[model samples]
Target chain A: MTLSADGSRAGRSPRRGLSMRAGRRLWLAIFLAPAVVLFAAFVTYPILSALAYSLYSWEGIGRSGFAGVGNFIRLFTTFPYPRLLANAFGNNVIVFVLTMLVQNLTGLGLALLLARNPWGARAYRAIFFLPVTLSLVIVGFLWALFLNPVFGVVNKTLGIVGLGALARPWLGEPGIALVTLTLINAWRWLGFPTIVFLAGINAVPEDYLEAARLDGASEWDVTRRIIFPLLAPAVTIIVILTFIGSFNWFELPYVVQGVSGAPNRATDVLGLLFYRTAFGEVDTGLQDIGVGSAIAVLMFIMLVTVSTVGAVFLRRREVEMG
Target chain B: MRRLCTAMIAVALLATFFPASVLGQEPAKLSFWSWRTEDKWVYDRMIRLFQQRNPGIKIEFIPFRAPEYATILSTGLTAGRGPDIIHLRAYGGLETFAAPGFIAPLDFEQVPELKRFPLQTIAGARSRKDGRIYGVPFATQTLVIFYNKKIFAQHNLTVPKTWEQFITVMRTLKDKGVVPLANGGKEGWTLEVLSGVIAPNFYGGTTFFEAVTRGQTTFRESAYTGALAKMLELRPYMPTGFMGVDYATMQQMFINEQAAMFIGGSWEIGFFKAQNKNLDFGVFPGPTERADQIPWVSSYADGNYGINAKTANMEAALKFIRFTATLEFGQMFTDLLAQMSAVPGVVVKNPQLQQVQAMNRKATPYIMLVGFRWQAPTGSTLLQSALQGMMAGTLTPAQVGEEVTRGLSSWVDAFRGR
Candidate 1:
């Protein structure tokens, strides 16, 4: 027997290597098949189809003909569409900004409080996270009733507190409707970030605090300079997820304000616009799937670009802190 | 075990190949779909009546939410997997289905009762492109002011006959701390209906509608803007914080007797009675600008029943749709639904429904729906938003006119010249 490379016999080496390669190939295929198939079917296929559909004029489900960039042009130049598209995009930006601000501050504050392991800390955590578990439909519908001008509990509570002067229609005013919707959305999702931040705080090593204390650092100083920086990963996740959620928001607003985002389109969002365009308005009963697809493609590009850039920036910060 | 499995497979294959006719046991079932979920019980009663007359066919009535119905129906029809019979919306709503041949076309020969309906009424179910009637016209909804009889009696206010008297009545109601109008700005469609009740009286009704359609005038004309201005004049008499009030709330206000009047469709009669058995209300044509002016209400054909083009049970579907066109179905609809039936010669026994029919005689087409719903940037959409802005104090009446004119001008050649 002749040794090959190391101590293996030359005759046996070729057969063993060949079988090992074949076995590894089979195992790789087995492991990757489901994920690859799913990604192609759900992700790649939809994106490509939407891109293709955007370039054509569609009458309901039937493709009328290729229109090149006609659909996109219509979105930008059409009398009401340009106005609607801008309003929706601007509302999404507002939703993202307000949601991020409200979630982070409240979440971080709650996390810090719970980090002390106060009496019934687990119960408090459960209470804070409870809203996240409720169905968005129920939450939206309940909130709509609560905010009603005459019968709503919100206005009733204000009356009881003698703040009756401030009891205006929360969702009826065009100026404040989008803001009201965002705050409701924030209330629904506040629990998720609070739990994430709490976990991050708990994972902080106790020895670091002890060392900081030994050096005569105040609790506030230790938290500001130490624990805060260590929670970077959690913040990154919460921020990115909130951004995506805000842009893709549909159900809660749809349930509360409807597809028109009533009160003169005050609460219109990209998602609602997409749906109205695709399915036709309840009153007019005319649908333009080509324009709807165009809106979808634009939204997708925006989401992907912003999210990727944000993740890279956040991940870099995480690495720096680590 | 292998022999048992083989035997089971053989039985299943044989069952699939055996026709119901061969078995001479089961009736042929035809599925029906509609957006009138609220009317499902009534439809079930109607379907039972049809089943009694025709024992060999069983019909299934399925209803979906109004907002989701169009999408659901389109998706099902596209996949060649929808119901055999369909309840379709009229005008542009019917055209979307009919233009693509998703609905089977009907002829006067197939259903001779189609000749009973006037051309204008039949136009609602006719395909704009193909010029073929595709469905049986079902009902007509007229816009009118519904007044709480008790409140009007308490205030000694008979229905006003002119614009000046109407304002005086509203003012009196406001002074008495009653919401004069139960309408709101929260829902654009409700606002459109509110406009429909008030606008035509100022804009010369069918005459102006014809002129605009013929490209002789546009929405920017004073007659149209003046009508919008009239709507603004009633802002003070509307419910408190009316901008936040929705259709349900508006209905609640009227039903609860918090508001004295409601501008809504005639279809509200059934809903009002159902919600509040003790409620007493009466309908009136919207007051005119002058005592002599025609009190023109906006009216349109509401919906229709059609056969799905790809139905396997075509014979049964046609039979049922024909039943819908008969005077019997029309009377049942008018009595149960409390709206005007499109079927001619059907006596409306209900007093409230009779009043709606009387008011509809002076009706102009619900202009936006009849003339402008065929294309994108629809006139209804433009008018709704404009009216909302006007109510919100963001836009003046002329601006509302201009906005609507601008939107319609994009597709309407009549407005394009200016």
Candidate 2:
């Protein structure tokens, strides 16, 4: 029973089936060597040590010499580092276009009002996913003490409902501090795009929404012409995770604006200028680490070339709207 | 009993992995560290009174998190591992660990009370590229103002020495409704400590900090843009959206009296008498444009006590950093941290720390943390983001003195090629 005499002499000699296809290619390189050595020790060794510490000139942690690209030509010709890198890349493109228009129109109007399962729809989907389970340092320290422009309870409930001339200083206005931190990061990621658009509206095909509601259609034309074009793979997984969480925003504007993104820096971003240039912040006095490894290698080549060209142009609009 | 519970779990894993070689000759412990996480219960009661005056030593302490304690103490002393007494910071945060040797210089024979401090508070722990003295100088602070005194004795008011009687006593305590500047601007270093308490009486203090650290005259001079236009003329006596008032809501609007004055820093007098034990308050120092000028204040040197040059208990961390420069640990660190103790004679016994040690004898150098915080665009981070863009009007006290002489001419050889 030697494996049926070596599987009938390895199907009549193809050099004994090339040693059984080199013993199944050495068990597929020993089952892909520990996820390719843990993705090259935690993602290609910290992006090639932040591209070799963005060409030298360190200081605190010492490296001192080489400065070839000279900290990316002083982070784009210095003077407040090119106006704080174009005001932190224009506040990360206004926190990714106002957190993608306030989290896709309030996450597709709360997934079309919680896909009709009215009253306690699983306790209103765990109370709209309870601020994505709290801790962004307790939602930026309870929204910087409930937007404290004087003992805050939101300007004393807009001065007890009279609206007190629209209580302003909501984050000390520098043209409304990055739209009040993109509406508090779309109120803490609008329940992750309302549970991915209520599982893309309960997987849409109820006989193609009852043949477009027996052809009478209009529930806003079966929600804007067929469940918003079949919720194109949950809007391309929330537009490539809101373009990599709006350029990795950094701990709720560093726990409600402190790393110098205050009133003037108007909610600065490139993750609080790469954590005040690689962690120096006693109100940004020292740490350079060669311009924080050239702002972490220009934010990893702008979030991998705009989220891989917006995830291949939104996966070709989810295969031409599936 | 199951072989005596496996021989007492191998002598409790050999005393939890050789805690100093399982006590054969224990006591050299050391460690320390600090950032003051609220002075760890007065440094664990001053390390148990320096471990009962050094009975074969044993310290420990630790602390941290004061804004991630200078990047976790320079990444734990650049990974050579840390603590054997450290707590540094004064002057360019102690020349970022005494110009990289990671501290350990001191002299007068291993810190003989760094010869009783004051050479400008031991030049804030020295080391400007090896001038030496690594660390010891501990508390100084100053700044000034404070006020309240039961809202200036129920608004009868007085102290205003000059700046037009301090803008008519903050316009009669802002027409009596009060909040006469509990200072704010959502903490860009408390608007650089309110431009070091109103820019050293319109930037002429110590003759503009020795002509702006000898590059002859810089912060775009008109006496430092008339002290950033007297901090935008104390922006309508402060509080109302004082740029979204922060430093813990400007110390909870001056310990809840709803703000009568504040300015800040004599380490907020033991956190306003431990947050209001009948909060009266007093202090002063800022107003001078004329009542015979000598006002000044703006002090500095608020840190030190170093050692760790990879300290394997260097003689119990130099006898616990020379018992933190003596005078009985500077009168128990100015009677438990009300502060001022850069240790000279140390006999304040707190009458408001003896008027902050007599207005720190007309002090001066808080100018961007003493001579432009050493390097890379610092001058206290370009005057705390140009005084938070001149208190958010989006800048102009001559553009916060031309944005702090163009970020200290990118590295101050007296504002280089300005």
Among the numbered candidates, top DockQ falls to: 1
Model 2 lDDT per residue over A106-130, tens place: 8878888989788878787887779
The ten-residue window of minimal lDDT in model 2 chain A covers A1-10
Q: Give the Å error, residue A198, model 1.
A: 1.4
Best by TM-score: 1
Chain A TM-score relative to the true structure, per candidate: 0.93, 0.39
Which tens-of-lDDT digit does each residue in B175-207 have in candidate 1?
988889989888789999998889999899999
Residue range B1-418, candidate 2, lDDT tens digits: 9999999999999777777645657777778888778878988887898899887888878887788888887878888788888888877778877787878887898777788677988887886787888888878888888888888889898899888898898899899888798888877888888778877888778887897798887888887788778778888998777887788888988988898888878888898889888988889888888887678888978878888887877888888888878888888888988787888888887788798788878888888777887766687776777677777787788887888788778778667677
**Which candidate number has the best lDDT?**
1
Judged by DockQ cut-offs, the docking class of candidate 2 is incorrect
DockQ, cand. 2: 0.19
B130: Cα error in model 2, Å: 27
Q: What is the RMSD, in Å, between candidate 2 and the native fold over all Cα?
A: 23.4
